[model samples]
Target chain A: MSVTSTTSQPNYHILSVLVQNRSGVLARVAGLFARRGYNIFSLAVAPTEDDALSRITIVVDVESTPLEQIVKQLFKLIEVVKISELDPRRSVERELLLATVRATCDDRGQVVELANIFEGKILAVGADAITVSLDGHPDKLDDFEELLRGYGIVELQRTGRVALPKLDREARLRAVKGKVV
Target chain B: MKMTGAQALIKALEMEGTEVMFGLPGGCILPAYDPLLDSSIRHILVRHEQGAGHMAEGYAHVTGRPGVAMVTSGPAATNMVTPLCDAYMDSIPMVCITGQVPTSAIGTDAFQECDTVGITRSVTKHNELVMSAQDLPLAIRQAFHIATTGRPGPTLIDIPKDVLQNSMEWHWPTDAEVIDSLPGYRPTMKGHPRMIKEAARLILESERPILYVGGGVLKARAAEALLELAELTNIHVVTTLMARGAFPDSHPLCLGMPGMHGTASAITAMQQSDLLVALGARFDDRITGKVSSFAQQAKIIHVDIDPAEQGKVRRPDVPIVGDCRLVIEEIVKAIRELLATGSTQADTSVWKSRISGWREQFPLSYEPSEPGEALKPQFCLEALRDSAPPDTILVSGVGQHQMWSSQYWRFDKPYTWVNSGGLGTMGFSVPAAIGAKVGRPEATVWAIDGDGCFQMTAQELVTASTERIPVKVAILNNSYLGMVRQWQEMFYEERYSEVYLSPDTPDFVKWAEAMGCVGIRVDSPEEVQPAIDRANSIDDRPVVVDFRVAASEKVFPMVPAGFGNDDLLLPPSQMARKEFLR
Candidate 1:
């Protein structure tokens, strides 16, 4: 089946969910996503940027309906208190952070120049190498990293994903209202 | 309240809730054996130590509990190595207890001192040489905890003679302390639903997706859940050697076993798929062939119970570690949601067409009429699978039959196919099946052995018959050592030496009957089924079906040694059909 997208590139998606912290629960959820062949962009889970619940923000490449189903399943877990898509259209701001370099002395200057243009900092420096770090939308960081790789690359590391919804209080009240209705 | 080390061990095992054990007594372990005599534990005195080891594996596989095997130190303990290696490779949970030379006499080259712990480290999940009475309880408790947790495997506790006699307070911990302390014991559950949904989207969007099922499905008892996901998504299923019959091989969507000697359809389909979802099975070298060309086109999603398995081989696009059953159930839920929202469907017609062509082109072939001259190994494996109970546990010794059994047996449940998959130890099945039969007396068990292998552990037959364990023994009695012979035939130009037994072979039938067991010899091809039926008829005595199969017969659908799946050799007859089908 065709993806039916007129765009030349593949579609990408991002989602946030609240889950109950329990043994074997993470395995179940991650296993589910994996079994279906979904490629995860980034996944971060920690005590909420807000409530007592655990907030799990995941970036994936897919359409809308599957994301909703995932949230519904998350809600079914007794420990999970809430889940949301964290719409990028209305959210404040989020970024993907990466550290990578072409570990060679000759191309080190070129790598540093690109990192500076991306509003990134050089995290490490060596006689034959340099490490640059950047935080931004995943697409932007990926583009910057790709540009660096043209030089003989040496190492790479990434903080897969993190997100905070902009509609903090209003979204909570609306979620409560939706639950009641 | 002070207790001896032997007493502490007994108390610890009792605390871990051991109800029964299989063992034999010997001089090195006289002190521990003395305590065992009076303990409430019901010890089945197997005729041989090796029998005790395999009986323990059998029991564990059936009961889903760790089976205990107790034996004296030195040679007795070493005798159990084959069985322990079998459980290690197949991931069965068991506790093998060996009594050693007294601690005071250790490292002095004392009589019956064989370094049981050192010898078994690689063959077990964890092993301990308990030196002090105080450490006895903790060590035994740890052995049980480690043996039954995660991807369960055998564990050993070697009790030195002096330590078994040393005094210490006997206190059974109400809670299993070692279980609480296990650092790597955490099992994963469901992943983020959002990720699962996206995976569902990937499944729906892909034109060619393959489902690579593994032993995790059987371990999690997730067969039904996996089948549901496969049917909904319309993806084909291929299993690893350890994961035979996770989905019924007879089903249309099933692609059969994939790897060296796997169905041509399955391997070709895997090579062509763009997205391969691997569940439970680790990508072993045998399964992956040449890593560079294996699943080169497929974006993989790996779901497994062990985290270390996730990126250890070929990296996965999505690495989800958890129980296979729960993971699959959640995937099905996500797919249902996608369908409601009008997501795309998988067009698997091209994949199926290509696989069907491969199947017809080189269908699993065994010479039907080659007579006593060409008794293919597959015929024997197929006969055993067809004749045994659907739920019968088929334990195999290492070599040609081990791989062939993996290729042929349609196993649908856990514990059904027990072989030393990674170790490839010969003389494993006979003892392992004995352990399995002891573990689950209700289930049928068969030790599918080769003549060369059965002789290694044949002493266990006396134990089986004495214990009233009616384990059927089907010997593929090809006079030559089959796998080694195949190498000689293909690579060494039939320069046969050492691979063949001397002209006069021992009478296996009379030997079994001598041990108070039933024995049947099949001299002709027509007697195969009847002998199997007769062997199945025995209730209290073990039966041996020694099929005098052709000595020159070789296992085919061959993947020449040290090569990947692409270089598989079809029998000259079948190679011609590849062009005809095209």
Candidate 2:
């Protein structure tokens, strides 16, 4: 199944805001989202090779009409360099991980069997326990892990959402603070 | 020829075959930068000295070569600390060149000077401050040699500003002998062959024999030999976190990574096995659940390139050191002799069945609900993996994702998965992905970063779009510093103070677009895969998928540091079941 952008407007336009590196920069940016009642799907800060700048990737549901207004207000922050709407139409990637699973005695065999099928691993074991680890596309893992639900699952550790784009010359970083390297 | 210290430094680095140097220009290093203009080495000017240090680490990892970084003294040198410590923890080969105050002014606290030597002594494998211009060439040569050799780690050379501009005749020491004065540096290869033979005999005789592998395999570039041994012995293999992907994950006998987060079957297998051949793995606490219970029934054969690692933790029945590749080759020859003579024991089905029994006993599980109000990080990871190319190189920042990626990423090829495994460096992924993308332009690279860690070096995203490096970054953003928060929750009574991430939408989509990049935001579980697919659709221009995930989520099956693997903390769901089901 492919991700097809639908005519029905996306509930939220995924936005990544590039801002200057400064203390409380996240607070100011997050403040804007909070004021607008935009629930951030996920937010993280990463450094641009330029130390003075940091990129904040935020996933949130927003109505189609006022999205631009949100972008403009984000630019109002002194630390914000620019704002970009990530169109899934282009290239990107995401991933998460699961720690070991401890299946109940009765369900252990089937759980282990399912883990092998999903390319997951058995990390630890006790007289009556086991932990399995797996990483992949979330949906595929979800499908595989669903089979193991019958077995006792010890715990789940997940990374919050983090992402980046594909490469193209037009989008090549031209300058940092308008200064070319 | 007599030349300025800056010119000599450039010439020395050039001779060392350094193609790129990451650094930010500043006062003390100004003179050095002036000479850099005429050098052929490609200098990347970072915005901050810290980025340069980390970029050096990133470069070293991708290229499998020592990376060089230059900075001025004081804060510049201090700013480089995180990356230096990062390199030290990961055992990466890096050479840091920091400009110190004038040699005579060292203790005076001269303008823009700090105790570079004192500050870096603990973090670096070795630190030297060149007091004489005549020693510049020799120092550079030795630094490169030392950084890349024997348990590779970061090394630093603090050159005073006066030394950088000093004029002296350069007599490059063409051949500097290995220093013998260094303590515990010797790597021995001439171990008893009889012992190796005995080890092989143990392997053949034991009904349950397993190979415990580590990153030393990669460090030794012994993939071929490892594959050969695994195939010949028909032994199952388990890797440590640092040893992830040492053997192709697709190998049926491969048990994946083992430790606190390790698979139950692998741990049980190790416990039940009669013989365990430890390759390059140091038996860190993470892997050896409880030292006393670890491999309780097994006799271990520890093979490594470092002699010190032999008895550092669990003493080996057979300790072979020198080169992992060479030792493995020798072991193969001895084992072959045993088989040729038909003197060894036969198949190990009993042991395999025992391991199978353990595997059958415990298994990993996850919920299948489509992302809605609560978006699971696993959903995001699976989506990213499904959407990326088969050969994509996955890198990760340290924390839950780092462990999760090791467990979930399913890396079948060598070098496809890169992480700060030994060091667990938080800000490793983004810069490392950039370097990986740069080194292997045709390969797809993704950084599986945590929200807290992504923030640590998020600025590297600018490097991605600016350098036109196509590296996909999928952030598993549980707003809290998930790993630390887990520690607090489990051990510290969940007194979550600084752990909670204040919620907010930073408009990342508009930011990427503004930076002339692409961004995708997926809040619902249903949109996760679609967003990943859409992001992968574009071959050019970087994209970001910000998954709005649940907070208060803890990484499960954690064996808190210092605790044995058996001390694993079961998730709330499991705990709930135990309380309710009975």
| Candidate achieving the largest lDDT | 1
| DockQ-derived CAPRI band for the predicted complex in model 1 | incorrect
Tens-place lDDT digits, model 1, residues B490-522:
889988768986323778889889988788987
lDDT of each: 0.74, 0.73
The DockQ of each candidate is 0.02, 0.01
Encode model 2's per-residue lDDT on B15-104: one tens digit a residue: 999988888778787889998888899887665677787778767766777888999889999999888888876677899999888878
Model 2 chain B worst lDDT window (10 residues)? B176-185
> In the order shown, what is each candidate's alpha-carbon RMSD?
12.6, 28.8
Deviation of model 1 at B409, angstroms: 3.6
The DockQ assigned to candidate 2 is 0.01
Off by over 4 Å in 2: A1-181, B176-186, B189-192, B360-363, B492-495, B505-507, B510-517, B537-541, B560-563, B567-582
Could you give candidate 2's fraction of true interface contacts? 0.00
**Alpha-carbon deviation at B180 in model 1, angstroms:** 4.2
Candidate 2 global lDDT? 0.73
